[model samples]
Target: MMFKKIGLFVVIVIVVLIGVMTFNTFTNTADDPIFEVVEMPAIDTNAVAARLSEAVRIKTISTDVGDPPASAEFDQLHLLITSAFPLVHENLKRDVVGDHSLLYSWEGSDTSLPPALLMGHMDVVPVEPGTEGDWEEDAFSGAIKDGKIWGRGTLDDKLSVFAILEAAELQLAAGFKPKRTLYFAFGHDEEIGGENGAGKIADLLEERGVKLAFTLDEGMVIVQGMMPGVEEPIAFIALAEKGYLTLKLTATTEGGHSSIPPKTTAIGKIARAITRLEENRFPAALNSPASDMFDTLAPHMGLPLKAIISNRWLLDPLLVSELGKGGATNAMVRTTTAITITESGTKDNVLPSTATATVNFRLLPDTSIDDVVDHVTKVVDDPDIKISVKQGNEPSRISSKSGEGYQLIEKTIRETLPDVLVSPGLMLAGSDSKHYETIAENSYRFLPMRFGPDDLSRVHGTNERIYIDSYVEIIQFYRRLLENTGG
Candidate 1:
């Protein structure tokens, strides 16, 4: 009789919990009314595709150190850009900063209002030596076949450069003038780090005391199958980017022949230190931008995901741990850990006196460079292993999504891309926009390209290409952004 009574009480508690969860899932989520689906105007698909193909064929590759006195190919590409967009050069004031970097000023009627900067990089990463044969078409051939434009820069960013020029040229041809000034800043070496490219441009703008309304650069994209439940594509606009830190860990100890080496040899010690770091990973926390992202996505999610996301505060630990399992989403929430390069023994049989490894980290929004170094040092906890930061920077400030600048971008996106959910999220990758953070009121990192799982692998990977339809959408998005922002 007592056992029956306990079972019945357990059933009642389970029923009450289910009722509460169901209510929270349905009631806690509120739809965002600010965003509405927009229909973009028709474009000249053939002409735009042809131009993109030609742009890809130029081979304006940016190396690690950057070709300061740019190679002949870069010069040729510059000449092509000048001739290709005749209206841009004729009307807009043009200047080349940092030798190869291109900057154009479209003067507005009102100089008092801050200007908007549209940014893109003209350079592309070089194709791997052996992987060139892996491409469906010649990597540099810029082949237009099977309804796609194939080449190196088609997705990793020449599309943006071309789209900006095309949009400006068309608007100029249509006799449209902006109320606020529009600046087009194109860096020459974004792939290798943009130190001599966009960095120099930012310095020049700061010296001129030019305050920008906002800056948009390449980062995230419109992706399908990004979110689990949302069938429509999600347009992810990056509100902040992770900080970059490269720490060089060196371990020096007694060295001898490998056959009779010490138990704690230089290489062995360094390896053990790296292992400890991997085991004691940086803790994952839900940041403001990530929280906002989930909030925006909650309404579109299925019942299970919706319930969990809607009541994040109560289930914060569960959500963070579950999402922190790994991959793209994992990096968004926590400081990423990776060992990029390592060096140790001089020969197969001889142990080296010194060993080193490069530990790369992309810090979360809340984490700083110092925080990363400190955490790594604590985890390794070895006096012999010396930690030195090669290069590091704190994460960018989280741009306000509720501000006028973000709304302008959101409204433009809504009117241009129909049935897509726009969410403000963190950009895991580095971009040229990092340099413009101080100059602009808000710096957004996004590229208007539709990238799927398969298509995303093509960026700096084999068979890099862009679909004709996606290319047309990019052109439409830029035109809408310009028209809505200032024209």
Candidate 2:
């Protein structure tokens, strides 16, 4: 009887604890910024659409084939932009910084205020050689039909380039002047490496001692279906970006006929190392940006998801496992491993003397290059496989979400996209903004348009295009963003 009474007491305690947790989870609310709603001003939709379509038609492709002059196509695109936005060329001081990168400066009424920099790459990745046939329309055709503009760079970045120019031209035509200086840095070779393009422009700005208030670049878009249980489109503004590192693992062994193979060949060794790295990935942790993202989103989530995120201290393991299932969510909390390229085998019957594999890692902030190298070496544990650091850079510093720059961005989103949820996140892909860590106090990555899962797949894949209505929304977003930032 005494044991039964103890069991009842235990059950009561458990129920009470659960009740308290539930109450706290339901009541917890993150402080959202309050801003006056600003309506998007009227503009010529046809003109904007025509210019973007024409811009997309220019085949300004960045490739690994050679250096600038990358192609006559790049030069043609530059000339076209100058012709397209004559007001921008007339008002803003245009300088050809790198081989083909264009930097336009709109001097402010108050020079004391640090300038604001807006960046976009004019280059697009080459469609896979044979996959051109897979496009709904020709990748370079810039075809506009069925309420969509079909092309390669239509969404990735050219949209920003055209929209930014359109906003600036409209503002310029209105005789609007700014309190803070504005710089538009359009890089021509972002797809290849951005070294000659954005890199050189950043160097020049740094040399001029031009400290910027903030730099905005292409990154996470305002998209729906990214979060579970939230029907509203979430605008993920990247507060921090993951570092990039490419490591080459090479295995060398005696070459001979495949019939007399040793215990392991060079190809076998490299393949095994890759498998080990894939199996034993870097440790996963709910890092700061992702944590902040959840904090901002939990209040908007529904029952079980809301409870899980709210009580993360008690439910972390299960939450992490759930988050790890999806590629997008998994990248937020952990350093990712991808074996991008493999090379080996001279012939079917002959064993190659050397094999090499390239492993790309997008490291979370606070996860250093040394930590990654150490983890990889320990995991592989192969003396024959030589590890070489091909290229690497540490992650950017996390920008504060409480600052004016972030708040202005948020305000703009609220005013333009009234129903969206704005959340801070980590950028998985590299962008030109990475070159400006030292040039600006806070750098942000956001593309102002909503994309679904299907649209997300089209970024670097087949059938790449952007909806006509969405393109107009993007232009309006930039216009509001500029007004909020003193345009």
**Pairing residues by index, what is the TM-score of model 2?**
0.94
Global lDDT scores for all candidate models: 0.86, 0.87
Off by over 4 Å in 1: 1-20, 34-41, 66-69, 257-261, 347-351
**lDDT digits (tens) for residues 306-386 of candidate 2:** 998888888889888888866788998889999999999979999899999999999999899999999989988999888
The Cα error of candidate 2 at residue 226, in Å, is 2.6
Per-residue C-alpha lDDT of model 1 across residues 1-487, encoded as one tens digit per residue? 9999999999999898878878778886556556554565567888888888888998888766724544687788888888888999999998888888989999999888899999999999889889978888988888899899999899989999999998888888888899999999999889888888899999999998999989999998998986777788988889999999999999999877889978778988999998998898998988878888888888888867788887775778888888899898799778989999999876888878999999999998889999998999899999999999998878888898886678887787777876677889889888998888888899888887888879878999999999998888788888878888776
Q: Cα RMSDs of all predictions?
A: 2.5, 2.2
Residue 430 Cα positional deviation in candidate 1, in Å, after optimal superposition? 0.4
TM-score of each model, in listed order? 0.94, 0.94
